[model samples]
Target chain A: DAGITQSPRHKVTETGTPVTLRCHQTENHRYMYWYRQDPGHGLRLIHYSYGVKDTDKGEVSDGYSVSRSKTEDFLLTLESATSSQTSVYFCAIRTSDRSTDTQYFGPGTRLTVL
Target chain B: SQQGEEDPQALSIQEGENATMNCSYKTSINNLQWYRQNSGRGLVHLILIRSNEREKHSGRLRVTLDTSKKSSSLLITASRAADTASYFCATEPTGPGNTGKLIFGQGTTLQVKP
Candidate 1:
């Protein structure tokens, strides 16, 4: 998984509950991203962080928030879980030394909202 | 909105044959990358082709990009059963404030039967 790990690999939560997913990287890459994969929607970026305390929204940032307080950790929070937000979440880090931007992904976390 | 769209959502081929996948994007991009994901696993970067470069090769994989057409293609020679997986094309959009964010396609599932 390219030295990236996501906690709580599988979780089943009820509606309106708060959920936070953690993504930790050993590579200390500067760029981190959170993405969700669904059946038809493919992979949609939720949010991304360029550096510590610097974050920005992606195409599907609604109902989700992200924080990067440390260089190796990026957190994705769901304020209130909903059925629509149930999907497989993946975290990725971009390679800095490579000539072309290539991303390495972490093992995904599967979340089910009831 | 999705930035990239893949052709042939699902494909079935026999071992020793060749497999090809196509991706088209909506905007100008700095580079195009291909990634493969096995079932219940994280995606692994396959190959990356810059906008200036027309073709790239890595082992048994070949990638070609057409900036004018805003499209790219991935060809796998001598496919094997172990190569059965989902392949996705991601593009890093060109322009100011580019944080190396990637927009991924829906992906094409390849089923290589032995």
Candidate 2:
């Protein structure tokens, strides 16, 4: 609802295969984030980009990587997908002004690894 | 480890009744936020209460923060069937380079019976 969109809304891949989820935002926000949602864990941050070419790891970044080439695009990639990496992924963005702490989210991408 | 833990893993209420969800966090935070997720969709920002703020309101939602107890509560009045969703509490840790990185709770699933 925040002018955000995720590519391949749903994806299925075999174990050891590679998967990439894309997030695009039209709002020109400076901060973008990647997160995964699980039943008992709720949501955990995977990776985030504070600015183009600047990224950082999150709580669960072990198996995931992210790249932000431009202001509108952020990508999350799994080099070797595994059953443990199967989860619903979300992308969020916020303005850099720090006027408000609210983060807007994209529709999400559901990935299944066999 | 999750910074916040929500009480009453699930809640059910009549459409017209009020619903309250509580969240407790272990660390000091700069701000606490509430988000809602419907089924398999991404999270939607509901409201945010800063550490210095006691209470804030938006539409039918009211949030209160008690830094002394390191907890927060969200109250939704005049609930509707459409309000059925999972609510999560996230905290922005008070530290350096915290560019809106949030640690989330397990969430409370709310069902509003029509």
Candidate 3:
């Protein structure tokens, strides 16, 4: 499991509400990623952090934001949730020597917006 | 806006049969990785093949990369029921910068009947 845990394994929220998902890794991996899996779209990257306080947007980062205040915690927040934002979210970690990137994933969080 | 496309949206095979899935990417890649996802869980990294490598094998899994054709394939020999899951392909473009954040492909749902 790589010691990666995602909180709120399942959630149902109304549109226009704010939702936050937390990813915690006990292994202290250098890289953390946020991805959403939708039907027919596979999984799309939303945000990722290379290190603490070093975060970047992914392909689907439009309505999402992420923060990494500590080495073990990466937070993905939806400023205003939408129906389209409902999907299964996954967090992954990578530990490599600056090359040969192989990743480890967490058990996902399934979020539904109505 | 996906970088990769995996063939055969779904597949079904017997436990003793072999399973093969293909992936096609749009851009030159530094490496390609295959991952497996069980029902309602996060993905697990299966194998990785670098651009310089044409083919690699591990246990019952074999991965072949054709950079010129911008495609790759994953083959599992003597498939087991446990191999039933969704498989995804991710690519990292060949470059000097940080393109390590993997861009995933639409997955192939594989069902191995026992």
Candidate 4:
């Protein structure tokens, strides 16, 4: 998947548990994003990071948080998992070229909350 | 709230035929992008068309954007079974402090049968 890797490809967790998903990129792209995909909701952005230590919320940022301490790594944390959060999570890195304005995605992580 | 909405939630066609998908967005955008996702996989960036550009082509794929209509269309010529997948359109809104974030549509599922 475009040099982007998301850890814990599949996970089964219980409600109220804390979970953290990791996204790492080899290209050191400046922009990183976290998204969740559901059956009918399509893909909703959870959060995004433009630079190290710089992050902002997306349309669906509730119940989720993100951190980017370094250039290559972006982390998404679920403070308390809920059944509603069960879905496929994807990470993406925007291409460095401003003209192209394309994004490369990671393989994705499937999480099931029980 | 979703920024983009794709038409024809599901589509099926025979190989060698053509396939088309449409997406409409709510607001002005700097650029629009298309992505493809196979079952149980991450998304792959397909093509991007800037607001100023009306049309773009890549291999067997063609994309056209109409900023006045706030819509875009993707056409695949000579479709193959391997092209069966979900296609999504994402838009990067244009405005101050945009932060290069993308809003994606629910997607159109295409099934090209051989």
Q: Which candidate number would show the highest TM-score if scored against the true structure?
A: 1
Model 2 spans with C-alpha error above 4 angstroms = A96-99
Tens-place lDDT digits, model 3, residues B14-79: 999999999999988888999999998899988889899999998999999999899999999999
Residue A42 CA error for candidate 3 (Å)?
A: 0.6
Model 2 C-alpha lDDT per residue in residues B1-114, reported as the tens digit of each score? 899999889999999999999999999899999999998788888888889999999999999999999999999999999999999999999998768999999999999999
Candidate 3 regions with alpha-carbon error over 4 angstroms: A97-100
| Model 4 CA lDDT for position B73 | 97
TM-score, structure 1 vs. true = 0.98
Per-residue CA lDDT of model 1 for A27-112, tens digit only, reads 88899999999998788999999999999999899999999999999999999999999999999998856566789999999999
- Per-candidate clashes come to 0, 0, 1, 0
Error of 3 at A51 (Å): 1.2
- After the best TM-score superposition of candidate 1, give how far the Cα of residue B52 lies from its true spot, in angstroms: 0.3
TM-score for candidate 2? 0.97
DockQ, prediction 1: 0.87
What is the overall TM-score of model 4 with all chains considered together?
A: 0.97
Candidate 2 falls in which docking quality class?
high
Clashing residue pairs in candidate 4, if any? none
What CAPRI class is candidate 4?
high
- Model 4 error, position A93 (Å): 0.4
Model 1 residue runs over 4 Å out of place are none
Task: Judging by DockQ, tell me the better candidate of 1 and 3.
Answer: 1
Evaluated against the true chain A, what TM-score does chain A of model 4 have? 0.96
